[model samples]
Target: MIMQSLRGRLFLGLTAVIVLAGGLGGLLTYQWAFDEAIEMQDSVLIQIGSVLQHGAQSAPAETPLAGVDSDAEVVIRELGTAPRGAVADRQLWGFADGLRTDSLQGRPVRLLLRSRPDGSRFAVAQQTAIRNEIAGELAFRALVPIAALIPCLMLVTALVINRSFQPVKRLAAKLNARQADDLDKLPVENAPRELHPFIASINGLLERIRLMVDQQRRFIADAAHELRTPITALSLQAENLEQLLLSDDGRARLASLRTGMSRTKHLLEQLLALARYEMGRPGKSPLVSLDQVAKDVVAELLPEAVERGVDLGFEIIEPSWVRAELVALAAMIRNLLDNALRFTPRGGHIDLGIYRQGEAAVLQIEDSGPGIAPADMARIFEPFYRGGRPSGDGSGLGLSIVKRIVENLGGTIAIENIQGAGLSGLRVTVELHHECDARATGRQQAPAAVPAES
Candidate 1:
């Protein structure tokens, strides 16, 4: 079960073909060179034999080149017509004048026999093994170029294949870097011709998805707006009914009805916020003091914290400024505090912090409540995802709204369960890039915390 990458498969197939062709061509080349070398050696033997027959009368009875070296092993000797010599020499005298293979001493040799006008027979011979060794060396030399060429061909092929696939890699990088709401058409002007069809298909799919998302946002926003009027009217009517006298049981039921209506109204409000932040774009952000925003949000929510007997205050505050919308930033902070208040039990505490670290402005919120379940952590930011332990009259859209606002401002939010040191709760931390110095704005510094009355 090997994963077949296109590039890998192409390289392997081409390399195999190159090796096969080189091997076959090399085999043919070696055989041809070997045969030619053997023939050239045979021609040398005939020349020597001719020289011996013409110069025999002037020279000694035997040639001085006999067993001179391993390479020049030619032997020359004259024999009378009566065949008076060793068994091997006598055997050669019986043969006709031409080239022939015979055994001399105990090893095989190639012989060229001839006769003069005097009727004396002579022979010139060399060992067969020495001739073959010379031929093999010549043939091997002919194969060096082909042996070197195969690897060079394979290397060039690899480089070409890699260069050709660069466009695909660039396309993937562009897609990966895009924001979630980026639905603009991709540019095809500079892309390769082979990728034009693929780019067009992707652009078409993006257009369709953008349209569907627009429709969904419109439906949610429109429905919430339409329902607000009736919900307000009903709440006023229920308040007016308090003027009439009622039994204890009836009063209890009326209280429940009011709670239900309140919850419904909160849910509708959250839905409208989510739709607005999701579909609308942030344009021309201005610098705002992050600590000031946190203080304002905490001041507004202090009365509710006091009513519930919860200690809610800023643990640390520093002057930090960020570029973002004032309204959106306040909403983000308010939603986080509201979520913390809903889960924190009476006598429990909530701590808020705002500070600067390097080029980033950090906002952190920690609450003393039951920590999130391991299973629910993955979907905590999803819309209407109430955790395993649903608490209070929560609409389950607080975190979703906060997340949308955070992302709209080009910031990041991380949520994790607080553990160790005998503490257990949820901590949310957000980091935003700093814009400018807070002291340069000439605004008055606000207090870190506004405690509710006892």
Candidate 2:
């Protein structure tokens, strides 16, 4: 049988303890019984000796045969065969001598011996059969109590061990009754101290899993809700184009339909990017230059900046590199710059800079625009969360994507208002672990400038 369960193991352990204790007790009882029986036998022998000596001295010399009794047989034999100076016999001699004594078998016998001077006779008397019976009774009595107690003691020990494990049994029952969705903390009171930590840790892991599952569920629902609108819009536009295909008004309607389709596509691309960031499935990371990423984002967004008549610029405070996924870093920088350019008014300035501060590489972006309110600042990075109504067309996903990418790259992002930047734009600072300086020799060449447009 499998003995891996708690009940099995506990039963085996309790059984072992019971058997050991009972065996030890039985062994001690047996030893005591033997010792007691031996003691009783010695007393019987001494009494027989005393009686034989008394009878021998009391009997007349002329009445030697008259004093012969079966009860004293043991003593008479011992006296007759005893060595000249011997005080005791070397072996147990039964009541077969000329002396008799009380026997353990409940009979009596007489004992007789000859005095050394002039061949005078003496008599000893004892009940030999009664003495033997008493010895047998004593041995039986000693064993009876132990035999009676063994089963009772074993039963009581089993009960005690089983009672001691009740708490563990209760815990198992409670755990088994819980539902799969129950991520609540366990009740630890009255639990064994050794097991409490394990229960608590399991509960902690369950709680984290519950939170992640909830987050994923919410993200799916939101994504579906957000995607439905654009899909409906595209469908309506297609239907309209199909209905009005033969006139000048149809051409205008088609242009409008194309614009709606383009916007929908952009939204879908942003949604896909968010999903990818969440899933962490953009393949393996590689080494990339944060400064180069910043330049590339600026270059890609330069046309948008020019269309808005905003001045976008970047500065490299340190020549360094970091190990990361190049595409993820580019996406993160692109989103941040996009947000800045979107918020900045025409003629407003957007500055992006990379520098090393101690062991961290810091990327700071400052733009001239309306800064976020204090209450909205804390949750700006949450997915699909927009800070009030945004100043320009936006999907409210830019900061969320940037946050996820930075986290995946093992970096941190912080934002605050830049008060004296003329326009009320925000300052976002991202900090990454600093890579080894590539220009420690003080003669390193500068990287070629990347154009504001690819």
Candidate 3:
């Protein structure tokens, strides 16, 4: 995942470089500063030694360098070339005139030994640990600023990286939010120069996708039209054959052929409808009577339901309106009713309703049939996705067409089990933005056709 995101990788890489460089640079700088401080301290020791030789101060006292800078831990000792005082003092007097490393009181010290004008020997000494301590302090103080700047640099790096990748993030969001059917070209304006070519390539791909989708819809439309003529002619010929059928077996065969022909015709009509909606429809939406649309579709399919011994009627027919194209609304309701009537068993009941729900108009259809399986509910709207067990004859495109129509009309549909509706069945509820087109034209008429059960 880190590798997949350019921003994350760049931020990490840059941070690693900053930390590595800062650490190395800080160490090198400390080392160099320590060395320089040591040299300067050595120079101080030499100057003090030169002054002492010129009778600058008497240093035969018991304490270490009393009159010098308090922080400078140096001890001036007097020793005679006779090598006569203590064995340690005699050992110190043995060194020649210059600076040397020696031990004083069993501890390491930097000693500057010189012969005085009267030939007496004197030593300027500083403990090695004290010299190193001073150098280390100065070096660490010098490194503090650089250390502080490292965190600041990291913060700046993060900010710059985030800002630089904003365009990519924005582009990703735009792509992710786009509908699958939306093949609009990506916008390149205001994008970074580095992403211009990438944006252009994406736009080209979108154009190709748009063209492919258009061609597919057009082909479906053309194929349905081309098949319609022959199928109608065949239906006429089949009717003519039915007039002269001789035997029962032949009649049965003819009936089966007619059934197949009817199913084929229905399938072709569904395909054409699907193609028509997919190509886009309804430039401007007007007020549509939701209750009226549902009633008309239910009425059209009433004869079929009656033949199947299914009771189909409106349960709640309120005066509800929606802002949508009338044709699209009719098709959507027709498909839902058709599905319900097909699935319902003999003597089963189906319910149609329309009422105001919050800010939308709700059109609900409930059927007394086995509801969809738990697993297949999510994918029922997908085209041709017959569930694990398809119960009825269908082109598998009915619901697909209905879903497209609903989306084009800016409505939402949901299907679930009718839990406590006195039937183990499926319930479909469609919600669309409500708009009362004619509030003045009151609908006091109870329902145009509410059956005895309602």
Candidate 4:
């Protein structure tokens, strides 16, 4: 997981290198310094031995040098020519006149033996322990800088890597902040030079996607436009058949044909509606009253509701305005009311509400009917997707169109089954952002809870 991040990988790799180099260099320098110090101490012993070789030397019997180890002082002892009873003294006498390591009074010491001009052999000796203590101190001082520098270099490396990757972070942040409708190409000028090719490739892909979407929308609209005339003529021909004398069976079949044709025409209109919004043509004048649109749709649809023996009325109303295209908003509300009317059994009731919810204008409509199945709820908004519930005289594009319109206007719509109240029903809620108050325009947006048309 640590290797997944570019910064982490770089930091770990560089830190490892810095630590390894410091550790190895410190080890090598300590070894070199220790050897050098030892050699210098050996040279001091040789110099003292040479001085004693040219002069008369005598043994200091029954007297020992004090305060030598406390001061890190070399233990220099002279062993003159005498019958040596101690094994260490015998071993020292057996050696040739040069520096060597041997025991002195049962302790380790470096011995440099020399013969003076008076024919008395002399030995200059220093404790090996005191020499090693001085050498270790010098070597440790040499490694201090290397030990301290590794962490400092690691910190600087982290800062440099983070700064270098800021451009990538900025690019990601910009992409994340864009709206779904925003398809503009990302600017490559401010990005790092190495990222130019990648950015250009992304821009090219976006252009292709934009062109593809445009073609798809244009195709649907053009096809719908071409089919409208023929479908209108067909409707007229079907109506003309209604005026002709025919058998009862023929009349029933004729009615079925007309119903199918009407559904087809409505389907085509829905396809055209979806295509129109897909092109993203939001009206320039976006200030519209949500409550007024709902009222108008209710008034228009009331006669149909009456014919179906359904009861429709508003539960609450308020001056709720939104920034929206007038026709699209009307289409959305009409579709919602139509769905409610179609599924609602004869004599069922539909309750509508329009009110302000914080910064949003909310539209809530609930119908007392056999609500849609829970399993089919997720796919209810898909184009031409009919659910398991019995849907009468619909192309299944009504909710799809409403969804598209709501999305295009940057609003939200949610449908859920009504629980409790011993009623099988569906409740739909839509919330649209309010950009300005309708009272400011003095348009008398809507009154509260007016009666539904009978």
Instruction: Estimate the overall C-alpha local distance difference test score of candidate 1.
Output: 0.84
lDDT for each of the candidates? 0.84, 0.66, 0.83, 0.81
Point out the worst 10-residue segment of candidate 2 by lDDT.
85-94
Better of 3 and 4 by TM-score: 3
Task: Count steric clashes of candidate 2.
Answer: 53
* Prediction-by-prediction clash tally: 0, 53, 0, 0
Candidate 1, 232-266: lDDT as tens digits: 89899888877789888988888898889988888
Candidate 4 lDDT over 94-160, as tens digits, reads: 7887888877677888877777766566666677888898999999999998888988999999999
> Candidate 4: deviation at residue 139, Å?
3.5
Window of ten residues with lowest summed lDDT in model 3: 445-454
- Compare the candidates by lDDT and give the number of the best one: 1
Using all chains and alpha carbons, the TM-scores for the candidates as numbered come to: 0.75, 0.48, 0.75, 0.75
Between candidates 3 and 4, the one scoring higher on lDDT is 3
What lDDT is reached at residue 440 by model 2? 56
